[model samples]
Target: MERTLPKPKGIVIFGFLLPGILINLFIIVIPLILAIYFSLYKFTGGIMGDFVGLSNYAQLVKDGKFWNSFKNNLVITGLSIVGQLGFAFVLAIVLQSKWVKFREFHRTVIFLPVVLPAVVVGFVWTLMYNKDYGILNKLLSSIGLSSWIQPWLDDPGIVLYSVTAPIIWQFIGLYLIIFMSAIQNISSEIYEVAEIDGATGLRKAIYITLPMLADTIKVALMLCIAGNMKIFDNIFVMTGGGPGDSSTVMAQYAYNVSFGQFRLGYGSAVSIGMIILSLLLVLVIRRLMGGTNR
Candidate 1:
């Protein structure tokens, strides 16, 4: 006689996690594993069969172009984070003030850019920065500053910073919203007590408001760092990593290596490196911010 068997316990557990597991495997784990595998080979003429061991990584260490791209990324990330978060916090504070009129209208106007597509922002900024007959140049010319106008995307000196202008413009609104929410979460009682104690506006901000917003600052910093580290679309559309690769970040460099030059192995190595860097940065940021009880 045939006997029926009970369903395994492990199967039930697996079923519970199946959707998330499948998504992670397909979206993150599989691609990571494939990248590692590809990084061990040397591709030539559409062939990916030759294994090169750790040579790809070794070459990465000696690659000036990779370092240059990495430096550009660092600069861009630093500037974007500082400019975006600093001004966002200021704007949040200003909007929270009782004296500010039409707060909702101001918030809506600031947030409009956050909802725009990155490509659209890039194209719009490209037109604004165009040297010849572009709005920016025309405006400067009208103001008798035409000599100061230059090819924003073509100048190696200013290309990275110029492209970053659009990025900062697009994302500052999101951070502003984050800061505003955090500001609103602060209790009115605390502000009232501070005022009763003869605390000035600046003093209240320093002692009470900022201290309460510490956790929000940490979260905002993490998001800003991660987003800036992996920046691509804005740079791609605005500059195409051009003007002698002045604005090329690791993502753009990896794309160029993999698809543009068919150096799949090198590109995979770059991708893996980027992943490692991202993980390290996240861990470091978490540890630093974890000290705050909030």
Candidate 2:
């Protein structure tokens, strides 16, 4: 006699997931497919009646402006990730210190910037960096350091780094929160044991706390990398990729190609390039971080 098998529960599970699947396909998959399809054609003034094959990609390789924007993005990403993570880690350590009074107040103050809108942050920084009447120049002049003042967003040499400082400042609080949460999750008993063993404050922090926070560090680094890679709003609002393309990043480049220049096909190519670069960086981060730990 043949035995009858039970109906699999996968059908019910799939039915539960079907709506989400369809939504993702419509929202993400369809647009991605359209972008790839459009990347092979030439769009003139928002019209894409002509097919250009690989010419657009070839043009990107030879485009000096595109490469310059690409390099600017690299610099911005590098500075933002390093500066944000370093500052956040230091802030986390400070907040976790038992000797620090009013820890809650300090944390609240530090995290205020993270909740502020990006456009607002950009405008505030733009005013602060204004050459003549800006507070930064005023402070420098007050200290009799007048010779050090320069155009913050106008100089091509320092514009990219200057714009990055505001972006880093805005997000540092979020990363600090992440690190502090991770630090709190660590068992106090471990600290007690270390202290009983005559461990100094620095020794306990270096050997116990830092090592225990490795997983958190990895997560924070990944976040910083992804966030910096897609930086657009701050650069757009502050510099507008101006001062001779001094602070243009990848997203801005793509925006210029698609909307500014009305070359949707080439813009799609640039977007695809950015996507690929971001993916590669994510993979590199995973490898460097040992593929995540529980």
Candidate 3:
């Protein structure tokens, strides 16, 4: 007779998931519901006012500042895709190469920034971008390229990109580690076979390693989309959407509207707008990537 294993009891499974369920209910579900409910009213002065029925959202549609911030968010997201994911992929490939030495050291150094507090990274980069005495301008001066120096944080034209740079630098290591792990899981025999067939490393990476990493790449792209959509702390600490709202993102705008201007109803609407937009973008990405996590 063949041996059989017993299935877990429903109560046991529910017991195991109880803490997570409760946490989500209190932390995420409840807040989201309240935000939606509050969004339907003219909530202000710490009291829910008369129902406005999407008037706040209607105003948000015409709000120039909100759209400007959304555009800035798009720019940051695009740059993040190119900078963070792109560089991480390249670094992962290089580190996986047999010719590279001190792989562990390189990994550690690259990932060190990811573990640092976001506020700390922001402050450090802000200091580095200081035009008067900052290291960036000083380095340019030292290299006889002083013209390259600009008011990095103060200039509206370049402030967005300036804030974006530190964010990219801080997070590259995370995706680098992710890709490296995915690459490691690719079988050695596949590469060996490609090598035996006189295929070059580049060809093997393109044809074999890349195809094998399809699912992992999809996951990475999704993560990038979601994370960049709501990016806040780094830009907040660095510029506070400064130089007259040049680098403001959706999250920061919602914050300013809620706390800065004391417009809780509109702020809740903005918050809901962010959630809807993020979900829609994620859905589009999923569809474009073939709509399967497999």
Candidate 4:
């Protein structure tokens, strides 16, 4: 038997949600509508030019640099799923173990980077990736791995990965915290029962913990996709899509086109493209993961 509570009156519910609804309308919905409207015209230099219709979008379909940036974004998203979510899950498991000491201290230390500004993180990593005075090269040289040291930010081949490293490092702690909270919500009796059944820690985690964390993992994946799709600040400060636009992502590409090149209309189209692609990716992920629709 279960008790049922009365649903709130419609007006009361609307009143309670009015502020948030208004804020989102002003901040997100309105701007998005404007971007879409601008995307259909030839807007340049703060002036509306010829009505381009779908020409900008047609151009976008054939834009090599835009596609390249899209590829980079996919790479970053994949790396984030593997690096941030994967590492965080492992670390969270370790922290939850009985033998791990000073768990709180470790949690706090890991999460410290999450509080720092993205620009600051980018600047710090940029200095570290310097070929000449950078500590990375120095450390490699000291350890007799001199041959392994190549330009982290200069080479187009590895610049994408190099920029991605900081993004992963900065956000791992956030996912770790999320995983920790999810793990805590699992029943202690489940672990106890598993132990009684002679299940090892690894086996228990695989069979029990993983199954229970499916929803959390789904949410984390969604967050990773959404966040990386619009990632700008870190890459902006670190590489500025340099080495000849080798490491650019969609957001940066959009920014460069809009403000940097004064192609506001095309930039808006790029932005709309980003939103569509992001939504598509999220849908694919949801479908693949057997989403909450059931």
Estimated TM-score per prediction? 0.89, 0.89, 0.95, 0.94
The reply for model 4, stretches above 4 Å from the true place, is: 1-13
Model 3 C-alpha RMSD vs. true structure (Å) is 1.7
Compared with the true structure, what per-residue lDDT tens digits does model 2 show for residues 147-237? 9898999998889888999988988889988989998999999999999999987798789878998888888888888888888998899
Task: Estimate the overall C-alpha local distance difference test score of candidate 4.
Answer: 0.94
Q: Over 4 Å off in model 1, which ranges?
A: 1-17, 44-47, 285-294
Predicted candidate 4 versus true structure: per-residue lDDT over 1-294, tens digit per residue? 999999999999999999999999999999999999999999986567889899999999999999999999999999988999999999999999999999999999999998999999999999998999999999999999999898999999999999999999999999999999999999999999999999998998899998899899999899999999889999999989988999999999999999999999999999999999999999999899998532
Candidate 1, residues 1-294, lDDT tens digits: the string is 999997679988889999999999999999999899999999644656688999999999898888888888889888988889988988898899999999999999999999998888988898899887689889989999978888989999989889988888888899999999988888999999999999998898889888889988888888888888888888888888999889999899999999999889989999998878877877787897784455
lDDT for model 1 comes to: 0.88
Task: In angstroms, give how far residue 289 of model 4 lies from its true place.
Answer: 0.8
- Candidate 3 colliding pairs, count: 0
C-alpha lDDT of residue 51 in model 2: 88
lDDT of 3 by residue, 62-126 (tens): 99998898889889988998999889988998899999999999999999999999899999999
RMSD of 1: 5.9
Clashing pairs in 4: none
Q: Cα miss at 174, model 3 (Å)?
A: 1.3
Residue pairs with colliding backbones in model 3 are none
Q: Which candidate is the best by TM-score?
A: 3
On TM-score, the stronger of 1 and 4 is 4
Better model by lDDT, 3 or 4? 4
